[model samples]
Target chain A: MKRVTLFVGHYGSGKSNLAVNYALMLRSCGKPAALADMDIVNPYFRSADSARELEDAGVRVIALPFANTNVDLPALPSAIYGLVESRSEYAVLDVGGDDRGALALGRFVPYILEENDYEVLYVVNFYRPLTGNANDALEVMREIETAAGIRCTGIVNDSNLGGETAPSDIEATVPLARELAALSGLPLVFTAYDARLPRPDVPGPFPLTLQRRPV
Target chain B: MGNKVLMKGNEAIAEAAIRSGCRHYLGYPITPQTELAAYMAKRMPKIGGVFLQAESEIAAINMVYGVAATGRRVMTSSSSPGISLKQEGISYIAGSDLPCLIVNVQRGGPGLGGIQPSQSDYFQATKGGGHGDYHLIVVAPSSVQEMAQLTGLAFDLAEKYRMPAMLLADGTVGQMMEPVELPDEKDVEFTEKDWAVTGTKMQRPHHIVNSLYLVPDELERKNFERFERYRRIQETEARYESFLMDDAEICVVAFGIAARVSKNAVLAARAEGLKVGMIRPITLWPFPSQALKEAADRVKGFVSVELSMGQMIEDIKLAISCRKPVELVNRAGGMIMSPDEVLAGIRKMNGGDNQ
Candidate 1:
């Protein structure tokens, strides 16, 4: 199968929950997306949480081995291998948060990108470490590249992590993201938020925010 | 749409990441994997993506942690030394049970060894690269096409297990050039906000992503829970590809580029009326031990071929458990085993045994 999307970011930047929502969004659109877990760095809140829920929603959840200690043995499932070799379209992988987690990509990126056709997105939140400024963000990118062995292709301005985040914050980070884009010669692909937005006119890339209506 | 282009294994991976919907790429420069970063630098922006050349292997992996926290499909690739720097982050990701893809287009070493492809990381991946108790889902690609295909699978499996997945490649696979078909872009669909903390909306609370469990019992519980997931993963992710094993007297086991060369040797041997078969491992972590054990029972002996001195050969021996004599045919420090070299080893083994 082909057409898999990977979600990556630094620790505490909120990629797991984002992965779940994004997978759900794709599912709502009548697409059969699969969620694969490749986060081998951080210690919590992974895509495995919604496995049954995603499976119930017709999204296949790639399962991982459980951990008894912080260092529990990694137990990868067989279907995972099958999926890597499968013919399905639209698989979503939620990578671990941090440059070290990114190191896991050392071997497969060549194969996945070439044979199956996948994409890698660097989720940049201005509030996090090494991404606090244009230079810091660039530094983070460099670190990720060092770990992954590939340069980042673009930036995602996901500049919020709860606690009274505002539209202005996202707006401010947009320029930084753009600046990073310019420096790296990569496009600021898209920006995302958990709340509603005013939809700014500064448009070179797509901006998306997560705002669910009240029940 | 046909984009059948000739490219080196490294650059090919960079291009494939874009097609696979990988938008965030991070990594530092390392031999064998450098072309991948150079390629991402030129291509990521043209299609709206982020390509960053990180400061160090440690920082790169931490950045991956940040971006991955946002629940995006991101990747980082490196060689052996760079991979070593990422071990701490890898341990954390495993403890936390996050899903991400790590590629190691391996080069030699214990420490800054050399710039040659080596399978020395076999134990690191299967046995756990860091100090903690975690196992990565390691996939070993023997060819350029497999490099791309396994990357896609690595993402899927990572998500499934909430664990780190590795694409274990060698310098030969990374530096070599080959013709490959890129995946179509029209098929990908992303829904990253489901569990990602894009700042808690008015509807939910803030999300916390970490690997630290300060409370002893709680941490213990978390560890056990993670083990449960790994247990399930083991039942599912073991993979291997076999060739001409049905009536063969000798079976060879190998992975990554070595397997490709061994396949050729097996064919050459078969042409000479020698009953030989080759077993190629696609996933090195959940090793196909059973398959090797079965082959050991049926074959007169097993030969493990690798670019390293004798890394994966140990696994073969452990799996076969002295059922049959397991021989080693290796080329270390940047040297590759030519078909003739491997065949020679096989012939010598046959002669020695027969005598």
Candidate 2:
């Protein structure tokens, strides 16, 4: 697993949900995991909104001061810097959705780039209108990378229909995920699924406990 | 024209705007409606159109005003709070009688409420949101296909009436995916505006697009003329859909996402030998009062199902004129009213002897 995993995707693509689940997944494997909630664009369904659950699971959570508040300011808490610099086994950055949201990630590009051990995972949900197809997903990936000043190292197929997700839904997106992987020249690292659902045949299928609902 | 593509409601609205000859889109990023702006940003440049991300919602609506004054089919979209910020500009557009499209993918709010889908903005959208004696031609779409179709209709109505039109959608419709048969790109001919601010190259008098009138009488005349246009709109442009109302004893009135839920509940109630039906108001500003008044004579009672705490109920009562009792089935603050909850409400109304 990459030490520093940055999860980026469009809104309602389940990035924050997966980020929170991934943090707990890492800790369950005995790896010290810390999560940085860099999503200042969306006020709901963010990793910061699930900070209590994540912290209860023994995972460190870093969130903005005004997170989950009605104050829609884009002020990132300074604690994010300290969280990133600490000697944790794994650090997950739950980025905001889309290019405009990814602008917040630009400030940490220098530190992230200097580390040289970070991986940006572009979470793709075939259900989302903007990233529904391979071409659209690729376009969104390019836009996010351009805005964040970083290259996406892999794709995480997080295709879902919120709580209505079925196994067919997971199976249906495998081909699009593969096409997106080929078009973007990035690896399909994993397919995010509910842990309670029957896993598909795809390799590296990451089962996640559904923590957050779609915003 | 037969191609069906799965699409989100927000993206469908954007594509429909493009196909309807909208060349200018200015908006700020807000959840539940951001996909519309993002879709426009990607496709507008390819089509040689302008998609500008403004500094704020206030700026975006003002930009719409500028683009509308140029006689171009332009649009701006935002969620509830952002739409609140654009009220001043919306009023200005209304006063100037400029045609434009504004989409509100509504979230919960009295303040910066939760980002979940809600019908709390019905009063704001149907009633004048901005401070003025004005009315936005409000179209409420119930599905993804309607999201696209009503967008085309919104532009057509806006241009036809020489007034602003609003596509009032909730977060559920904005985010949900459904197969939609998109409209073909047509060569839409906009109504030639003799009052547009196109530069006068010595062919005619200079056209000025301003809302200000220092004289009280002139301002009153403008208001009267605008109200006259609104009267025409109310006369001819009211739109609504009736489902299973012929033999329905209990009629549920709703619009947008709430109507979608009400349809399911109505069907489920009918399955158990209860007579339930739905009246979906497609045009909220015109209110569909005539249809409701006609339905009130036939149906036993009315039940209003909405995502807000009874905002549309007052209009329902006013439309029916207290001839029938109107019950409310709603969940406020971003909580969706489930079909089961609506079904229970239907049963409660069905068991009552008040009707």
Candidate 3:
């Protein structure tokens, strides 16, 4: 695993859920992980919305001061800069949903490049309207890369039918995920599935617990 | 016309707006409504139209005001919280009588509520959210296809009435996917904007677009004129869809996504030998009060089914003047009422014991 992993995807693509799961996975493996909620676009379903749960699991959560609050300002806290610069074992930046959301990532590109050990994975959920097909998914990826001033290193198939996801759903997305990887010239890093479901025999089937929204 | 393509409700609204001759769209990102902006970002530039990701919802609606002032069809969309921010601007548009479309893909809210679908904004949409004696022609679309069809109709109504029209939707309707046959591009001829601020160039008296009147009498006159327009709208523009209401003894009053669920419950009740039908108010502002009142006369009782805490029930009662008991079948704070729950409500209203 890379030291810094940035997750970016379209809205409703389950990027925030995957980011929380990835942070927990890293911490469970005895890594000092920190998940930064850099999503300023979406006001809900963000990693910051689950900050309490993540912190309870021993993951350092870096979120904006106004996150999950009534204030809708796009204000990022200064602590996020320091968190990004810190030498944590693993840092996950749960970025906002689309190119507009990924614009925040441009601010940390310099520090991320200085680290030289970061990976930006363009997460895709084929079930979403815009990213359902390979071409549209690639289009979304290119748009995000252009907006964030960074290219994605790999593709993560984090596709699922919300709480209704089954093992068959995970297996069915493998071919589409491979096609997306091949067309975008990005490696298929992992296929994320519900941890409770039976694991699929696909490459890098990462298991993730369903992260419920904080009350 | 395009072939039926599977599209999210948000994307369909965007495409439909483009086909309806909307040349300008300004919006800030908000979940359940962000896809509309994203879709516009991709297609607007290609079609030589303007798609601006404004600094905030306040800025986006103000941009709509600017674009609408020039007699161009323009729109802005947001979810609940964002819609609240745009209320002041929407009021300004209505007071000025500038034609524009504002879409609210509502989520739960009193403050920063959850991002799940909710119909809690019925009062906000139909009752003039911002401060003023004004009204927005509110249209509620239930299905993904209606999300497209109603968008075009929203632009038309806004233009026809010279008032802001809102396409009030919920998160479920905005996020869900369904096959939609997109409307063909309109061969529109630019309407004569004698009242527009497109610069007179010393040809005629410069048209000023202003929603202000310092004199109390002038302001009163403006309000009176606006109210007369609304009265006309109430008479001619109130739209609704009646499902199985020919012999309905129990009527379910609902709209938007809640109506979709209520339809299922209504059908289930009919299967169980209950004469339950549905009245879906498509135009929420010039609400179908007359139609609902007519239905109330025939039905034994009424059930207002919604994703909110019975916000629309008040309207139903007011429409019928409490002739029949109106029961609420609802779930608030983003919790959807299952068809079974609605069926139970219908059963209870049908003189059966409550579940």
Candidate 4:
């Protein structure tokens, strides 16, 4: 089964960064990766905005005909169906920010879940709303599942995007992630480098898988 | 045996959450929803559960984030204004795919509109309360008993999908009292969280949970995958209740309290010998358009009866594909239309259609 990775987050929560980085990592590892831009929510930060950058890196960018709109983006291209058919090494889907973008999740659930095996990694930023706590985060997961009709496969605590983020913020959020893991029944998948961060004095047998990426 | 109790919609949700194995409750008090917070606060500590009245809606949702991260069932309740405050948080939660329940005892909105029974927030709850490209498992309850049942389902669905689920009740549903037999607490498998960061503890690996992705291409991938899940939701989870729709010549499309009122209107219209029926959307987010489409094929026309000024009418029109005339019966800004008033609209439409 081809490994399809989906990068999801709220607006300005750093979903795009992770999607791009992961795609790059996959390509550099000599794996062919296809990146599809399906974010009809926020048109500004879409992967199509940096189409050249992805193309330069040798990743196939699935482009939409018109600029994305909040209410009225054209139905997602049929190419998405073709790509899922390809069964590439990694197919990256960069979703829009928040629940409204989740509406777009409606268009694709049938094709993807039935066709290609996909991993939905709900990335969280502790500083972000809804995800700042364990309980609320679980609610977010449920909403997505109800809206998208697919169960969450994993969780990514890529809690920072820019300046002013501290290791303590990550420390403070660890327990929340533990609870999220227990609730969703999925493992907490994270970067291996995070182990160097100052550990919290919390207890856990967190279901986590470490992914080592080139920084 | 758990205690059987009669309670208001708001209080029943509080009681039902406790019965459903939810031990954590966090929320700030808002009008019409104040009772729910009070009930949770009163009951949480007694049962060794946790309840905190946060300083603001943002704080409350963030606290929900904190507790949900622990992999426990939890919930928050608010009226329109407070729900507005929590929208940012709701979006973040949707983005991160967290499982929690959000109860909205809706009041008039577009900014602190009113304290009366209103369904004005129907669009917000069913559409998207938060700023992200996301959707809540928005369930609009028609009765106080349903308020209890849906709240428990909200928690179950929330955990099931790893997404936010909302129990949408109007002020009427929240405040109205009714007899209810809350379900027995059965052992539910809160499984599938082998991926959550309960804590590394030197066991497997360090885990991170976030909605932030700085890469453009990667974000696109994520959004598309979320779309995949939404499609599945549309296919399997869309729910609505149809009353006398199969053989009726005319249909009323409504939800929540409006559906209840429309039921009376449909019956009265039938008494007057007008073939009328109703389609009530229980899952407002999924918006049982398919049912309406099927109904539209049978009915000559449709009337979208809502508490707001035609908010849901657009959906009815779209669903019917404009095959026939779509009329609207609505009252806005906390005013509710009586069954007689709704019947009048149906009569007028029928009167015109027949000629």
lDDT of 3 by residue, B103-214 (tens): 9999998898887789999999989889999999999999988999999999999999999999999988887766677899996557769898888889999888898899
| Candidate 3 Cα misplacement greater than 4 A, ranges | A1-137, A144-215
Per-residue alpha-carbon lDDT of candidate 1 for residues A8-71, written as tens digits (9 for 90 to 100)? 7664455665667667768888888887777764323356766766788888787566532333
Q: Which DockQ values do the candidates obtain, in the order shown?
A: 0.01, 0.14, 0.09, 0.01
What would the TM-scores of all predictions be? 0.61, 0.79, 0.71, 0.61
Off by over 4 Å in 1: A1-215, B186-188, B348-355
Clashing pairs in 2: none
Report, for every candidate in turn, its global Cα lDDT versus the true structure.
Answer: 0.73, 0.87, 0.87, 0.74
Evaluated at residue B291, the lDDT of candidate 4 is: 87
Candidate 3, residue B1: lDDT: 10
Q: Write the per-residue lDDT of candidate 1 for residues B53-101, one digit (tens) a residue.
A: 8889898888887777777778899999999999998898777677778
Model 2 has how many clashing residue pairs?
Answer: 0
Write candidate 4's Cα lDDT for B221-323 as tens digits: 8788887887788778888888987679998888888888889989999998899988888888777888888887788888888888778888787778888
For candidate 3, write residues A69-166 as lDDT tens digits: 65657788887787768765589998987888899989889998998898999898776656777888998999999999999999999777655566
Deviation of model 2 at B183, angstroms: 3.3
RMSD of each: 22.8, 4.8, 6.4, 24.7
Residue B208 lDDT in model 3?
Answer: 84
Question: Which scores better on lDDT, 1 or 2?
Answer: 2
